[model samples]
Target chain A: MTRRIRVLIAKVGMDGHDRGAKVIARALRDAGMEVIYSGLFQSPESTARMAVQEDVDLVGVSILSGAHMTLLPPIRQELDRLGGGEILLVAGGTIPPDDAAALKAQGVAEVFTPGHSLEAIVRWIEAQVAAARGQAAW
Target chain B: MQPDREPRPGTAAARPADPGAEVEAARRAYEEALARYREALAQSPEREGLFTTLSGLPVEPLYTPSQPDPDYLAKLGFPGEYPFTRGIHATMYRGRLWTIRQFAGFGTASETNARFKYLLEQGQTGLSVAFDMPTLLGYDSDHPRSLGEVGREGVAIDSLEDMETLFEGIPLDQVSTSMTINGPAAILWAMYLVTAEKQGVSLARLRGTIQNDILKEYMAQKEWIFPPEPSVKLVVDTIEFGSQHVPQWNPISISGYHIREAGSTAVQELAFTLANGFHYVEACLQRGLAIDQFAPRLSFFFNSHLDFFEEIAKFRAARRIWARAMRERYGAQDPRSWRLRFHTQTAGCSLTAQQPEVNLIRTAYQALAAVLGGTQSLHTNALDEVYCLPTEHAATLAVRTQQVLAYEIGVVNSADPLGGSYLVEALTDQLEAEAEKYFRQIEALGGVIAGIESGFFQKEIAEAAYRYQREVEAGRRIVVGVNAFRQEEDRPPEIFRIRPEVEADQIARLRRLRARRDQGAVTGALAQLRQAARGGANLMPYLMEAARCYATVGEIADTLREVYGEYQERAVI
Candidate 1:
């Protein structure tokens, strides 16, 4: 028996371009992952609380309004503070290379850009979450 | 055209008298030719692989005249005639070219001002302002929640002082400026009017558009401040005020640009935008304003996507639908009210980050569609826009894209160049029918606001987006550099980064303005705005007073927030 992979697709802050977030949520759900979507205008603290409360395996934060540097790191720290320290943090949207590197340094496990496929994201999340649980090798 | 749908008298009876025998002869000839066409399709070499637009509208292998072909005059009259399928204006692009308005903003007010001057120097006709996220969401630069977001995406505008700097050297009456602001559009619009007053321009001479279509904000763009009722009231306030004072300005640019960018189908974009426009018109009528007084200035904004013919069909269908509805359904007696004037922008969602330069080709084609489909104004997206704000070179190229089309392309020689083509007319009719289907569904759901509350528009858009991605992933849809042409590695393009100091600089400026402005006047004006929000009075006058006194946009918005609550929607994905 295998545990279902649970994930939270979060849109933090005031970036209202949620197309990417919504699309990825459905893709992950179709791939058999239990997904929790934090709608819009969510603070970093509330996102972290929702991630912990939902007991998700990963938190995929999306920001396209070019505020990733000011918004993503706090979500990472808040998730760590709320006892979800090991929860995988992933992000995507108009993030530049330097900011992507900085976000990685601050604790984002992986970063995707506009060109990445939904399949690639799903595969990466499944591999990382599956590896963390030490589940059977598919 | 039907007499009831005609905007002017005596135009319906002008069609040539029916040629009874010739019409029958043509019908028989068409039926015989159609059988041969079917035979050719069955024996085709490639079998014509599933040709369809991104809207899921099936495209036929070939189109020819139907039995008893439609009368030309009835279907598409003169460009300026009723049911304006050909175009809204008769002298389309001959007297004046479509406004080359590129949507540009980033960094501080001074930086954006420099860019605006540079664009004007490069022959740009109109100024389209794109506010940063904080300004778009109605937050002051110094707000704690505005942390790293000030001036990141667009220009940071916090007060009348910032608006003054934004248009310092530029005269408002000289060039039309369009602001891409919703949510707090009333607050920002008040700022512009006050800036015009400071610039010493008459309010009656002001011309431009405010993207104040908040119904779409709740349904698609989702940058709403107050809930539906209050936000719509504010929009009506602007329309009412503009009709009286700023007679030349377009108060509400009912937009489908954001809706299409939000991953809706082309037909859904057409349907949803017009439905939202209807909602605004009904709101104004409910407020006891004449349809003609405010409806003429109500313009539209649409998206030009990579689907060449599909996008054109959407535009044509939009014009015809609007004209018919205004004249027949709403009984708008004014000819200007019957015309649907829209500005088109090449779709940002169509631009891929990979092989970023190829986005130029996509944009050029999309701009061509907009021109061929009769856009009154256009903003071509730059290649670098997918990753960051466009660099100067890229933005210039975007402006140049329009210049070449205007000068060299000869596309503007006549109105609706593809007007009479069998395929184009059929597709236009198809799109109109499809849009009517969606309109009926929306009406059944009680209206645009009700549909938003029930999450209907959100769910429909999500499904379409998912379907698109699934098709792309399954190799059914080929996105040039992303899917078909396999590039081993993308050479990272040169990126333009907004300076990190922008956030701090804007915050300090906002704090200083708050510190120096007449505190008592600010409080008094905002109090008045709040009172008007609580009562039945129009809020625009109060907002203008507040803006004239250097009241921050957030202060006025927050005061209204105290009166009318914020909007919150459930996640639909």
Candidate 2:
């Protein structure tokens, strides 16, 4: 039997622009993955709790209001506190390259920008899930 | 190319007196031209396999008289006439140029106030306010949910004090203001009304528009607070109140700007926007208000995208369809109810961060299209908008782009300058037909609210957006600086950055206001608002009392939420 990779997507804080997040959710579904979408205006604590409840293999956060610098750290801390640190975390939306690099260093698995292809995102997620399974076996 | 030859015996021209023969002769000539085009195509092929507009509508190589052979009087009526396909006004820009209103607001209210004054000094005719994420989502500056987002995307207004400061010196009766707010539109509008009262301006003397359209929030912008039923009730309440009290104000501006920004096609923007408008009309009718009483003040806002002809055609069709629907379907008698006045903003999604300066040229062309399409007002986006809020210089340049179009470009000299072109006429009809099909589908789904609940709107917008992204990635469509004409540069354009201190200052001010204001009065007013909401009474009067008491936005919104409950969108995609 094959295992289906489940992922959770959410928009945190007050950013209302969700077109990018919706597109990513649809693309992930089309790629034959199980996806759960947490609708808009979620707090970081609620988002982490939902991710843990869903027991997903990956978590994706989309922020476009330039609040990533102040919003992501608390979300990352909450995820760690909830013992979901192993759940691969990704971020996307109008993030500058400098901020992208900073977020990656602060425990984000990857960061996607405006024009990044969906195939690239799918490939990255698949690779991360496979690597996590191998580590679990070891 | 070939010269005209002598008519054959069977050709229509052979019998000049017969009109049917002449039609047959024209058809024969068209077929011969097609054959010649195919032969030439075999030798030197066209650049692309299928040519299409940005919205993916197919276009023919050439349009002729036979295509879209519409009667000029019926289809393309004179300006200011019924079925206003040409324009809503006869003189258009010649009588008075479109108002140059720029959308500007950021950082603290004081800072935003300074920016507004600067724009007015720069010859901007009107003001359009952009509220921050917290304010739009109904959060006070000091709320925990608003921690890092205070005054980031736009100005933060927590109480009537902030609203007063935001428009301290500006005369509410003279300068018309347009606020780009939803979700908490009623609360903020109450603040504006109280501020005007403090200035001794009568409600009947005020002139402005509040972007109180909530259906689009559920459809595209995703800034909704309460569920559809209550949110829509609140919008209708404002419309009802404005009609009786503030005659010069537009209570709701049915907006398609965010729909196109969310990546819907030109036809979808037109269809969805008009659908929302019709839904609003039905809601008002259900309230027992006569259609003509409130319909005249109902306005629209649309996105002028990069597709030149498609955008113009969308506008023309929108006016015609709206006029006819108001007259025939709604039984409206007043000519003012038939007129569809709108404001146009250049598409923000089309602006590119790469080669930022090129966006200026793009905006200029879009402004020209809007003028030709006969928009009542216009806001041209700055070059650096895709990165952050526009800088002072960029906002000025955006305003100048409109000035150049109105004065120097000569496009304003004639109304509906492209009214007679066969291609433009065909595209207009094609868009109207496509929109009718969507309207039918929406009707079958039990109207716009049900369509939203069923995820129909979300699915359509998502599919359209994804398809556009795929096209850009596959090199099928070229977005000059993004996909094609790539250039390597060391540094990007200098973008406007909000200081971290802005949030701290705003939060502190909110806390101080809470400490100093009459807390008992605020609580009482909010309780009254809650009681009003619990019943079927209109909540505007109660909200006005709360705003006058200096109640925070969060307090008012929370009071309503207690009764109506907050909305949690079902995952659509």
Best by lDDT: 1
The TM-score values for the models, in the order shown, are 0.91, 0.88
User: What C-alpha lDDT, on a 0 to 100 scale, does residue B63 get in candidate 1?
Assistant: 30
Among these predicted structures, which one has the highest TM-score? 1
- Candidates' interface RMSDs, in order? 0.9, 1.5
CA lDDT, candidate 2, residue B29: 51
lDDT of 1 by residue, B314-377 (tens): 9999998999899888999998999999999999999988888899999999999999999999
lDDT of 2 by residue, A4-24 (tens): 889999999888788888888
Kept native contacts, fraction for each prediction: 0.84, 0.61
Question: How accurate is chain B of model 1, given as a TM-score from 0 to 1?
Answer: 0.89
Q: Model 1 scores what on Cα lDDT?
A: 0.87
Per-residue lDDT tens digits for candidate 1, residues A10-89, read: 99888889999999999999999999999998888999999999988899999998889888999889999989987888
Over B92-172, each residue of candidate 2 has an lDDT whose tens digit, in order, gives 555577999999988999999999999999999999999998899898988888888988889999999999999999989
Provide DockQ values for all models, in the order shown. Answer: 0.77, 0.62
